[model samples]
Target: MKKLLSIKNIIISIAALLLVWEILFLCSSYSKALFPSPLMAFYALIEMIRSGTLLSNIGTSMYRFAAGYFSAVAAAVILGLILGRLPKVFQYINPVVQLLRPISPTAWMPFVVLLFGIGDIPAIVIIFIAAFFPVLLSTVSAVGNIDPIYLKVAKNFEISGSAATWKVIFPAVFPQIANGIHLALGTAWIFLVAGEMVGAQSGLGYQIIDARNNIRADILLATIFVIGVIGILLDSLLKSAEKRILKLWGLK
Candidate 1:
């Protein structure tokens, strides 16, 4: 009953917001093309849905996102584990990482476009770049900051090499690494959209561009709203995955 009430309240709040928006739209002197009402945006969303353009763009964007994000996670975690285990290697690489870390992934758009041309390649590369450092740094920190007593325990048990790294260290640092993944996913999504907007011919980002070019403010606004909804869904999915992992590790 309480949960139902909570959901009801949320719906009411959203409805109120839309009502206010409609009222403002009616009162405002601005052109509907420039500032579309919620109803107009909804109709636009329906049109896109009916035509299958929205689903196609969403699928394309998700494909690029999943490919790049998973690749980044794999590469970053592997490299982070190696570096975390060997301080000397990390020390040598730290300077270069620090230098590159501050640069925005979007700033690489021109270079990637020039090198890879306008397509999925540049978008995926941008997502990878955006996601890589966060996961790497988080993993490295998590692994490096593990307690000395854990290592002592592993040594006493004679769990050496790959066994020690996998069984002992990986489990200990996984929670922190999961947190990094969450953060990286959000950053990757943002970069993916921006990359798609600039380079890709077909995506949610391209839809936004197409809307703007065609002077369809309703479509643009609807796409932006859909982006937010998709982002929330992606975050929820990652959190669910993290929870499952933590549960398996008995850390939850």
Candidate 2:
């Protein structure tokens, strides 16, 4: 059963989809210009490769994604630790965070575009918005929920003052932080395309928009395929990294 659902299965599924797409393309009177088959899409992908646009676009998106994602993780983790330890501080920030968290990243596109002026900065800023909250809230919750018994034990060990936090609080917060980071990673990745599409001259999002405008369904399909694949790859990489951290921390 595992083998049945393995990489081979993915290939088979894609092959079946292509077969259906080709059959539909053949039967329909729709112009090829409107709806190209899978083969045409594959061909267009090759053309994109030859034109040197594919790698450049993909690289730009990945770079923007990395910047935003890393910024979110750094800010969230540090803030999460501080707020989790001091609920009073959390209270101070809570109202503003609550207000901002509900605002959609896409809704901020116009403002971001105006502030950053049609560039990578706007897209990067958007990604940061989309990712930071989940990790922040999760870390706060995790810290608050740390076992009281453990705190008592740390006190018994005379591990008081700031030393207590690094030794006890941070480790206790790890499981929650891990989960939050993983969730944030996926969320940020999804938002990359939407945020990037605003006025991007090049990137995966731009590639999709360009394809659509040109009526190159094959190119559009290929761009979608690339984006989906990249999302999956990034998600899997983060999950593996989290599991490794858990193992190293003896929490696995």
Candidate 3:
């Protein structure tokens, strides 16, 4: 009942916000060309949905996002595990990692474009960069921060090598790693759109640019709304997955 009420409140809040937006739009002096009303944006969204352009753009974005995000997660987790197990290796790479970590994924656009040219490749590469560091750092921290007693207990139980690492270390640190993944997911989505804006000819970001070029504020606003909705859905999906995993691991 509490959960249902919470969801009801959320719906009510959203409706209230939309009402406020409509009121503001009615009062504002900005032309419809410059600032579209929510109703106009909703009409544009319906048009896009009917035309199939919205689905196509979303599909393209998802393809690029999945490819980049999964690869980054795999690579980062493996490297993080290795580095976490070997402090010397981490120390040796720490300087280079730190130097590169601070660089924004958007800042890499010029180099990425020059290297990969104008297409999905550059966008995927940018997403990978956006997703990698957070997971890597978080995994490393989680592993390194594990209580010493757990390590001793594993050793005492004759749990050694890969078995120990997977059964003990991974389970213990999963929450922290999940937190990192959640953070990276949001970051990757942001960079994916920004990357697509500069590199790809399709996807939500490209549509925004196309809408602006064509002087369609309604379409632009609708695309932005879709992006926000997709972002929320993505986070919600991750949260659900995290909860399931935690339950399986007896951490929930």
| Inter-residue clash pairs, candidate 3 | none
lDDT of 3 at 116: 84
TM-score of 1: 0.94
Error at 2, model 3, angstroms: 1.6
Candidate with best lDDT: 1
Off by over 4 Å in 3: 156-159
| lDDT tens readout by residue for model 1, 23-89 | 9899999999988999999999999999999999999999999999999999999899889999888
* Model 3 quality (TM-score): 0.94
Prediction 3 global C-alpha lDDT: 0.92
On residues 1-252, what C-alpha lDDT tens digit does candidate 3 reach at each position? 999999999999989988998898999999988888889999999999999999999999999999999999988987887788888789989889899999999999989999989889988999999999999999998889988988999999999988988888888888889999999999999999999999989998899999999999999999998998999999999999999999997888
Stretches off by above 4 angstroms in model 2 are 1-5, 27-29, 158-162
lDDT (10s digit) by residue, model 2, range 1-252: 796679788899878988998899999999888888888888988999999899999899999999999999889888887888799888999999999999988899998888778889888988998999998999888988988986898899999867887888888779778888889888898888998788567789888888888788889888888888899899989888989988988978
The stretch of ten residues in a row with the least summed lDDT in candidate 3 is 77-86
Report the lDDT of model 1 for residue 82: 81
Clashes of each: 0, 0, 0
